[model samples]
Target: MSMSFGKSLAGSVLALAAASAAQADVPQVATDIAPVHGLVARVMDGLGEPALVVQPGASPHSYSMRPSEARALEQSDAVFWIGAELEPWLEESIDTLASDALVVELLGVDGITTLEFREGATFEAHDHEHGDEPHADHDHDHASEEHAAHDHADETAHDDHDHADEASHEGEKHDGHDHGDEEHDHEGEDHAGHDHAGHSHEGVDPHAWLDPENAKTWLDVIAEDLAELDPENAETYRANATAGREEIDAAMADVETMLSTADDVSFVVFHDAYHYFENRFGISAAGAISLSDATDPSPARVEEVRDTIRDLGVACVFAEPQFNQDLVATVSDGTDVQAAVIDPLGFELEMGPDFYPELIRSIGDSIASCTSSS
Candidate 1:
């Protein structure tokens, strides 16, 4: 064969190998939850499917990472999680396990407004008392109660001051920096490379996805990030996200319409996780049975909730899949209040590109079930 012909053949082979290498560089994405996976899945449609870390029926709050899941994280090009507040177990693991992977916390993304746990929600903030204050002249017990109230008021004021100061500092930081940078901190001040540490989990609700608007914000961010990572699929990602937003908007409209007719709808949930959902849709929950599925309320607290149920004439007592149903039964034992199961985590539902809309609809359905009764 001619030397010139041999050289041309070698060049062709090298070009084909380079093309394969470029395709390999397309990111292998990983997400922490089913709904997040659902969002990412839509953005990556026709490009590739993302790996899900937490599977259906598992609780992200208390889930232990498995060996295979760790390996998936290590192999991923980018990892998307809600935030450390929702999945605290991932806080240490993602840093250690996926050290090289690009980690994006969805809650930290701009345009997504976060909700706080209701002021009087069952997850009461730890009351750190200030120094004792002098009480007015009164009976011993009355004076003590007044002093305690004063201390609480003082603590609340101090917390408010600290939070305001932190917000000012955060605003200054953002004025000179990019919004989506992992290092710039989304929740007030930076936490020295730990974004989660910057925000207090006590009052900040981590279930931001429950709000359709937040989900729309998420789609925009997801498409932007995915396009940056995979330029070849930029149009596809953006187009899919746009379509997803439209679907969410339409579904949310329907949800609002469906639940609009219920009169005096009052209920209780298994935990404080649904504040985002309840607040976004203009639904009011009486309270939660517990702060979290991992923590059980005391007998006295349980009795108090029962009294609340009786007094308020609650329509339904909603239970979750991760926790036991016995508590729900006990809460509604002799009452006419209906006991309904609402799976916030989509425990029994199928996970895919459609999971997000379906999950939202399920929540609407559960609320409608009891509210429509009376």
Candidate 2:
């Protein structure tokens, strides 16, 4: 009896050691934003959790990394981000800190659909084709060079601001039409650098995660990357990703059903960040108050948006949680337009595999509730 008990105890110890070894073998992954972190969390469900670089309620456009976040990057086995277009601030940090880590730029991923930046405060209807191939102008290599050029241009523009200001005043008095053209030219020249806040909006819109299809595509990419690092769990990673894709599809279908009640309802967003979600669901915003979230719309642009609301009889103006609510209030003050809050970042949601789908559903709910009432 004593001999049998000793053998059983030895078997239990061996099993525990093997389990601990497998756990230790899991890779340390890091992601830039909540949505990406949620997706990676889904893919790495059983293996490990990826560290989130940009925390909730913080704007990615102008975020400073905490020491803990920097350390997370330093210790990461792999780091994933949307690329310099979305987070130029992170580019240098990643190069400096996570030099040994495998970096995956999601914007440069193959089979992703990218949309060009729509100019001006109000957007015209876009008829641009969505293709599997990345746009030539937005090729990863070209984008990096363009980003570098924008940096140099920003310095030059800063130095020549006074000269440009004088030129503007002189041109304004000469002819209103010529002045308008000159102003447009100046804005175009600086658009990629700083005019629309700090974002590099010269080429593709970097909010691709808003599109469920892109999210699905990214799941496979995440799985493949994780598999490459830990081949022993390749099947598990791929399976988890496949499961994540199905969850997104199911959530998308539910969202479609929820939004069906508000098909004819017109709306405007705080910024032009929802094109991917809009285009995916066959709905479009009448106009955006700002070109991007980080930009503050000029008075003229705000007036134009007010005109849009009055003319289109827009049902709702969606405000973001991270932005000032006063802007939405100003836009909706005189009109019967219902002001509703929509969060693109899922700030309030608990971060996990389910967060992405919940974020999409919440937006749908916010829009549907307000528009249906209107």
TM per prediction: 0.72, 0.80
| Local distance difference test, each candidate | 0.66, 0.73
- lDDT of predicted model 1: 0.66
lDDT per residue as tens, model 2, 1-374: 69999999999999999988998999888899999999999999977899999888765654557788999999988888877666766777887888777788877776677776665655543333332232422223322232222121122122211111211212222111232233322344343223433334456777888889888888987888778779999899999999999999988998899889677879999878887888788777888876653455666677778998998999999988655567788888799888888888898899998888888898888888989988
Per-structure clash totals for the candidates: 0, 0
TM-score of 2: 0.80
Q: Which residue ranges in model 2 land beyond 4 Å of their true spot?
A: 1-6, 125-200
Candidate 1 per-residue lDDT, tens place, 1-374, comes to 99999999999999999887866766888899988998888777766788988767656655556677888888987888887656665766777777766677776555566654442233223111311111112212221122212111111222311222111111112213321222223344232211233233344567778878888877876787677768887888899999899888887987888788653677888876776776577666777776542344545556666877888888888988766568888888789998888978777677677778888888888889777874
The most accurate candidate by lDDT is: 2
